[model samples]
Target chain A: MAEIVSLADAVAELVRDGDVVALEGFTHLIPVAAGHEIIRQRRRDLTLVRMTPDIVYDQLIGAGCARKLIFSWGGNPGVGSLHRFRDAVQNGWPEPLEIEEHSHAGMANRYVAGASGLPFAVLRGYTGTDLASVTSTIKQITCPFTGERLAAVPAINADVSIIHAQRADRAGNVQLWGLVGVQKEAVLAAKRSLVTVEEVVDELEPVDGGIVLPSWAVTRVAEVPGGAHPSYAQGYSERDNGYYAEWDPISRDRAEFEKWLERTRTTGVPA
Target chain B: MSTATTELTYTSDEMMSIAAARALSAGQRCFVGIGLPSTAANVARRSHAPDLVLIYESGALGAKPDRLPASIGDGILAETADAVVSVPEVFNYWLQPGRIDVGFLGAAQLDKFGNINTTVIGDDYANPVVRLPGAGGAPEIAASCHEVYVIVRQSKRSFVDRVDFVTSFGHGRGNGDRARLGLPGAGPTLVITDLGVYRPDEHTSELTLTALHPGVTVEQVREATGWQLRVADELARTPAPTSDELAVLRALKEAS
Candidate 1:
C-alpha cells in the first residue's frame, strides 16, 4: 500500500545520501517541487537519472545534490548552456560531477529492461559511432538467430524514482496523461517510488491517453499542486516559458545560481 | 497588387524554412526534433501536409499542435496528439522499427558527407569550449527513418570538412559506408540551408548543390562551404516561397 504524505516527508523518508534516484519525466510533469524539496532537505551524493535533464536537474546539480548525472541530453531547451553543469565539469566548483552518457534509445531501453526485470536490453544503436567507447555501460551482443550484432545496455534500477503527474485518487492510484515519457517504467523499475500530483481526487476518472499506476506499485503519494511548474501538467498549466528564459542568467554564474538557490531556500520554491 | 516582384519581406531563415517544409509531402510519418526542424515540420503540416503524422521524441504520436511547442515535451504537443505513449514505446515501436518516413533535424555542424555533429564545438571532448545538448533520439532517428532532411544556416564554420564529433551517422565516410554499417535508412537525402538546397550525389555520397534559393548566388554557396563545393552541371533555381506558403507560415507564427 502507498502512504499519502507531504512532499517534504516523502523526500525526507525516501531519498537518502549516496542513493541512485531518478526523477523521470520527458519534458512535461518534471517534478520540480520534489526536486526543490530534495534541495531544501539538503540531500547529497545522488546519482540523478533522466533522459533530458532540464531546469530541475540544473537546480539539483547547482545545489550540490548530485554527484553524478546519468543522462542522454542536458540543456536549457531553446536557451544556451547550463552554466552550473559546465562549472561542475570544468572547475569542480561545488563538487566534481561524473557523467555516464547514453543515447536516448539506450537510456529508454535501460529503463525498459529494469521494468522487465531483465539484466540488459538489446537494440540497433551506436553502430559506427563513438558513444560505445565513451560509455562503459554500452556493450556489444550478437543475435542468436540471425547472428546480427547489436548494442546492449544494463538495466537502470534506482533506489527511488520520483515523478509529478496530473492527479491521483485518495487510494494512491496515480494518473498521468499528455507526454507520459518513462515515469511508469521508472516507477516499476525502482525499489521505492514517490508520486507527487496536482490533486488528490476521490475517483480516478480516466483520461484519454492516461496511464494509471496501481497503489501497490507506488510507495508514497503527495499532493503538490503546481508541482510541475516551469515544466507543466497536461490539464492544469502551461509551460512557464518566461521562467526558462529567465533561468539562463540565473544559472549562468555560480554566485547567481547560489543567490537563486538561497532565494528558493527562503521561499521553498523557485520563483 | 503592385507587381514589384513580390517584395522580399521574409528573411533567409524563413526562405530556408519554407524550402524545407515543401520537401515534406502529405501523410508522411515524420520523426521531428526540436528547434528549426520542428518549425519546418509544423509549417508543412499547416500548409500542405495536413495529415502528416508528427511524432515527437517525447512520445506524442500524430501531434497536431495548433501552436508551436516550446519543447518536445510541451503539453501542447500532448494535448493536440492523437495518442501519447511511454518513452520506451516511442523508440522501440515507432522509431527503431523504421516506421517513420522522414527524420527532420537541425545540426550544429555538418561535414561534406552529410554527417552531423551536435555534441561539442571544440576538438577536445573533456574540456570543450562549448558543450551542446547531446543526442536525444537523433542517433536512432537518423539510423531508422526512411529518409532525413536537415535544416541549418549555411556558413564556413557550420559546413566543415570534418565535424568535431559524429552525433548521428550520415554516410559515415561516404560511398558504401552506410550500407557496410547496416544502417537501415537512406542517410540524409536533403540538406536545406540559408544559402541553398543540397542533395547527396548518388555515387560519392557527398552533398552537392542541386538548387539555389532566390537571390542566393552559387558563389555565395561556394564561399560558405569549407570543402570544395560541388554544383550540379545544370543547377536549378529553387522557386521562391509562394504567397500561399508565406501566408500559412506567417499565420502559424502569429497563432502560436
Candidate 2:
C-alpha cells in the first residue's frame, strides 16, 4: 500500500547518501520540488539519472548533490549550455563529477531492461560511434537467431526513483500524461519510489495515452502543487518560458549560480 | 510565381531551412533534433508536407507544434502531439525499427564523408576545448532512418576535412563501411547548408556540391569549407524560395 506523505518526509525517508537516484520527466512533470528537498536535506554522493538532464539536473549537480551523472544529453534545452555541468566536467568546481554517457536509445533500453527485471537489453544502436569506446557498460553481442551484431547495455535499477505528475488519487494510483519519459520504468525499476503530484483526488479519470501506476506499485505519494514548475504540467499550467530564458544568464557565472542557489535554498520551491 | 531575377530577400539560415524542408515529400515520418532541424521539419509540415509526421526524441509522435519547439522535449510538442509514448518506446519501437523516413539533424562539425561531431571540438575527448551536448538520439536515427538530411551552417570550422569526434556515422570509412558494420539504413542522403547543398558521392561517400544557393558563389563555398570541396559536373543553382515557401517559413519563425 502507498502512503500519502509530505514532500520533505518522502525525500528524507527514501533518498540517502551514496544512493543511486533517478528523477525523471522528459520536458514535462520534472520533479523539481523533490530535487530541491534533497538538496535542502544535503544528500550527497547520489548518482543522478535522467535522459536529458536539463535545468533540474544542472541545479542538483550545481548544488553538489551529485557525485556522478548517468545521462545521454545535458544542456539547457533552447539555451546555450549547462555551465555547472561543464564546470563539473571541465573545471571540477564544487566537486569532481563523473559521467556515464549513452545515446537516448541506449539509456531508454537500460531503463526498459530494469523495469522488465532483465539483466540487459539489446538494440541496434551505437554501432559506428565513439560512445562504445568511452562507455564500458555498452557491449557488443551477436544475435543467436540471425548472427547479427547488436548493442547491449545493463539495466539501471536505482535505490529510489522520484517523479512529478499532474494528479493522483488518495489511494496513490498516480496518473500522468503529455510527454511521459521513463518515469514509469524508472519508478518500477527502483526499490522505492516517491511521486509528487499537483493534487490528490477521490478518483482519476482514465487518461488517453496516459500511464496509470497502481497504488501497489508506488511506495509514497506527496501532494506538491506546482512541483514541476520551470518545467510544466500539461492541463494544469503553462510552461514558464521566461524562467528558462532567465536561467541562462543566472547559471552562466559561478557567482550568479551560487547566488541563485542560495536564494533557492532559502526561498523553497517557486510558486 | 515571381521571376527568378526579381530578388527575394531572406537570410541564409532561412534559405537553408527552406532547402531542407523542400527535401521531404508528403507523409514522410521525420525524426527531428531541435534547432534548425525542428524548424525545417515544422516548416515542411505547414507549407508542402502537411501530412509529414514529426517524431521528436521526447517520445512525442506526430507532434504538430503551432510554434517552434524550444527543444526535443518542449511542452508544446507533447501538448500538440498526435500521441505520446515512453522514451524507451520512442527509441526501441519507433526509431530503431526504421519507421522514420527522414532523420533530420544539425551538427557542430561535419566531415567530408558526412560523419558529424556534436560531442567535442578538440582532439582529446577527455580535455576538449569545447564540450558539446553528447548524442541524444542521433546515433540511432542516423543508423535506422530510411534516409537522413542534415541542416548545418557551412563554414571552415564546421565543414571540416575530418570531425574531431564522430558522433553520428554517415558513410563510416567509405562505400561498404556501413553495410560491413551491419548498420541499417542509407546514411545521410542530403546535407543542406547556407552556402549550398551536398549529396554523397555514390562511390567515394564524399559530399559533393550538387547545387549552390542563389547568389552564393562556388568560390565562397570553397573558401568556407576546410577541404577542397568536390563540385558536381554541372552544378545547378537551387531555385529561390517560392513566395508560398517564404511566407510559410517566415510565419512559422514568427509564431515561435
Candidate 3:
C-alpha cells in the first residue's frame, strides 16, 4: 500500500543527492509542485529525466539541482527557446550540465522496456541520423527472425519517479486522464514513485480512458491542488498559457532568473 | 525600368501558411509538429481539408480544435479528439506501423537535401552555440510517415548548405539514400518556406524551387538561401491568398 504524506516529507524520503529522478509528464499533469519542492530542498547532482523538459525542468536546471538531463525535447511549447537551458548548455553558469538526448520514440520505448522489465527495446529508428553517433545508449541489433537490422536502446529504470494527477482515493490508488503521457510507465519503471494529486476522494469513479495505478504500485501520494499550474489537469484546471508566455522573459536574463528563484524560495511556491 | 503594383494586403508569412495549408488533402492523417506546421494544419482543417485527421505527439488523435493549440497537449486537443492514447502508443502503434499519411514539421536548420536539424546550431554537441529543443518526434515521423512536409521561414541562417546535425533524415547524400538505409517512408518530398515552395528533384533529391509567391523575386530567394538554389525551368507564380483564406486565417489567429 502507498503512504499518504506531505509533499516535503515525500521528497525528503524518496529523493536524494545523485539519484536518478524522473518527473514525467508530456504536456498535461506535469508535477511542477514536486519539482518546486525538489528545488526548495536544494537537492544536487540528480539526473533529471523526462520526454519533454519544459518549464519545470527549466526551473530545476536553473536552480542548479540537476547534474544531467535525459530528455528528448527541451522547448517552451508554443513559446520560443528555453533561455536558462540555453545558458547552461552554452556558458555553464551554475554548473556544466551534461545531456543525453533522444527522439520521443526512443525515449518512450526506453520507458516501455523499463516497465516491462526488459533489458532493451528494439525499433526502426535513428538509422540515418546523427543521434546514434552522439548517444551511446543507442546501438544496432540484428533480428534473429528475419536478419533485419534495427536500433536498440537500453531501458531507463529510474531511482524515483514523480508525477501529478487529477485525483486519488484515500487508499492512494491514483487515477489520471486526458493526454496521459508516459506517467504510468514512468512510475512503474522506477524503484519508488511519488504522485501529487488535486484531491483525495473516497472512491475513484470510473473515468473513460482513465489510467489507474493501484496503491501497491505507488510509494507516496500528496494532495497539492494546481500542482500542474503552467501545465494543467484536464477537468481540475486550465493551462495558464499566459504564464508560459510570461516565463520566457523572466527566464532569459541571469539576474532575473535569480530574482525569480529567490522569490520561489521565500513564497514556498514557484512564482 | 517597368513599374508593377500588386495589392499588399496579406503578409509573406500569411502567404507561406496558406501555401502550406493547401498541400494537405482531405482525409489524410497528419502527424503535426508544433509551431508553424501546427498553424498550417489547423488552417487546412478549418478551411479546405475538414476531414484531415490531426495527430499530435501528445497522444490526441484526430484532434479538431476550434482555436490554435498553444501546445501539442493543450486540453482543447484532448477535449475535441476522437480518441486519446498514451505517448508510447502514439509512437509505437499508430506511427511506427506506417499508419500516418503525412508528417508535417518545422526546423531550426535545413539542408539542401531536406535533412532537418532542431538539435544544436553549433557543430559541437557538448558545447553548442545554440542548443535547440532536441528532436521530439521528427526522426521517426520523418522515417515512418508515408510522406513528409516541412514548413519553415527561409533565411540564410536556417536554409544552410549542410545542417550542423542530422536530427531527421531526409535524403542522406542523394538518390537511393533512404532505400540503402532501409527507411520505409519516402522522406521530405515538399518544403514550404516563407518565400516559396520547393520540391525534391525526382532524380537528384535536391530541393528545387518550383514556385514563388506573388511579388517575390528569384533573386530575393537566392539571396536568402545558403546554397546555389535550383529554380524550375518554368517557375510558376503561387496564387496570392484569396480574401476567404485571409479571413479564415485571421479569425483563427484572433480566436487562439
Candidate 4:
C-alpha cells in the first residue's frame, strides 16, 4: 500500500556512496527527485549514470557529490562552445566510464543477457569504430565459426532506483504519461526501486496502450506532491529553465560553486 | 531581380544570411543546441572563422557531426564528438562558469525585450493547455551561456509581445536585473530568423533587426515579428557559399 514516508528517509536508506545510481528522466521528465533529496542530505563519492550529461548530472558532479559519471552530452551546444562533462575530465574531474550513445541499446541487451545468464551479447550494428571499446569493457569473445567481434556489456544490477511520477496506486501500480520506456529499463535493471508519486489514486487510468512495465515492477511508492522540483515533469510543471541555463558559468569555477552551495543549500527546499 | 545573383541558384534556406552566421559567431565557444545553429555554425566553422570551437551540448567538442542529429541524444554527436560527459557536468561546471561563449538555441517564442519562453503556448502553468517538452537544460543553457543565438523561423505569433512562461534562460532577468544581478552571460546576443539576423543595442539589449537574407525585404522581416522592430545601420549582405563549404557541410550531415 502507498505510504507517506519522509523522502529523506526513503532515499537515504537506499543510496550508498560509490553506487552506480541510474537517475531516470529524459531532457526533463520523470527525474529521480526523492533520490536527489538523499543527495542534499549528505555528499558521498557517488556515480550517477544517465543518457546524456545535463543539469542534474552536472549539479551533482559540480557539487563534488559525484566522483564518477556515465553520460553523453555535458555542455550547451553552441553558445559556450564546450561539452561540459568532457571539460570536467581535462580540467581535473575524475574520469568516468565513458560510453557511446548507442551504449543504452547495448546495455539494455546486456540486461536480457544477464537475466538469462548468457555469457555475452553480440555486436551487429555499427561494425567497428571506437564503439568497439564496449567489447573491452564487456567480455569480448568471437564466434568460432563466424569469427565476428562481439560486445558483451555486463548486466547492470543497480542497488536501488529512486523514481518520481505523476501517479501510483496503493498497490504500487505506477503510471507515467510520457517517456516511459527507459524508466522501466532502469527499474528492471536495479535490485530495488523507491517511487515518488504526485498523486496516489485507488487505481490508474487504463494503460496508454503503448505503455510497457506494469505495477509488479514498483517496490514502494512515496507520495511527494511537488517532488519534481528543479527538474520538470511531462505535463505537470515546466522545467525551471532560468536555473538550468545559468549553470555553465557557475559550475566552471570552484569558488562560484561554493557560493552556489550557499545559495542552493541555504534555500535548499528539502528535496 | 533576374540579372545579378540568380546565377548562384541557391534556395533561401541553402545560403545562410550573413547576419545570421555572424550572430552565431559572436560566441567564442558555443554549446550548440542542434538544428539551424548547428548547420550555420558548422558552416561558419568551415568558411570564415576556424577558431569557433563547436561544442555539441551532447559533449562533442568541434564534432563535425555527419548530419543533423535526430536529437541531442543521437550517436553522431557522441561518436564524432571529442568527449563524453555526465549530464550534470554540462550544467554545473561548463556553462555556469561563464565559459560558454554563447548558447545556440531554437525557441517557440521571443517577446519584446528579448524574452524567450519555450514552455507553452497557452496561459496556464498549472493545467490549461498545450505542454511543450519541459525545460531539459534549456533554462540553464539560456541563463548561463555568455550570449545566446536564437534560430527561429519568422512568424508574428512566434515573435510574440509576451511569453506564456519563461521555460529557458536568456538575458531578460525575471525582474529586469540580469546585468544588475551580476549574472555572467545573462542575456541574448543575436536572433537569426528565417528572414534576417537581429541584435540588441549597446544599452537596452532590445531585439533590433540587423541584416536581411539576399532576397528578403525589411517589410518581410517586419511582418514576421509581433513587436515593433528596429533595423541596424550597417545591414550587410550574407556571404556566398563556396563549393568547398557546401561539400564539407554535406559530408558532415551524411555521416550521421
- The fraction of correct interface contacts reproduced by each prediction comes to 0.72, 0.80, 0.93, 0.00
Span of ten consecutive residues with least summed lDDT in model 3 chain A: A262-271
DockQ, per model, reads: 0.74, 0.80, 0.87, 0.02
**Candidate 1: tens digits of C-alpha lDDT, residues A195-246:** 9999999999987878899999999999999998888787899888899999
The top-ranked prediction according to DockQ is 3
**Model 1 lDDT per residue over B151-170, tens place:** 99999989998898888888
lDDT of 2: 0.89
Best by TM-score: 3
For residue A112, what is the lDDT in candidate 2?
89
Query: Per the 3 Å backbone cut-off, how many clashing residue pairs does candidate 1 have?
Result: 0
RMSD of 3: 2.3
Instruction: Arrange candidates by TM-score, descending.
Output: 3, 2, 1, 4
Candidate 2 deviation (Cα RMSD):
1.4
Predictions ranked by DockQ, top down? Answer: 3, 2, 1, 4
lDDT of 2 by residue, A60-151 (tens): 89999999999998888888788888888887878888889899899888988999999999999898898898889999999999988999
Q: Evaluate all candidate structures by whole-model CA lDDT and list the values in order.
A: 0.89, 0.89, 0.94, 0.58
C-alpha RMSD for every candidate: 1.7, 1.4, 2.3, 18.7
Query: Model 3, range B176-234, lDDT digits (tens) per residue?
Result: 99999999999999999989999999999999999999999999999999999999999
Alpha carbon lDDT at A58, candidate 3: 89
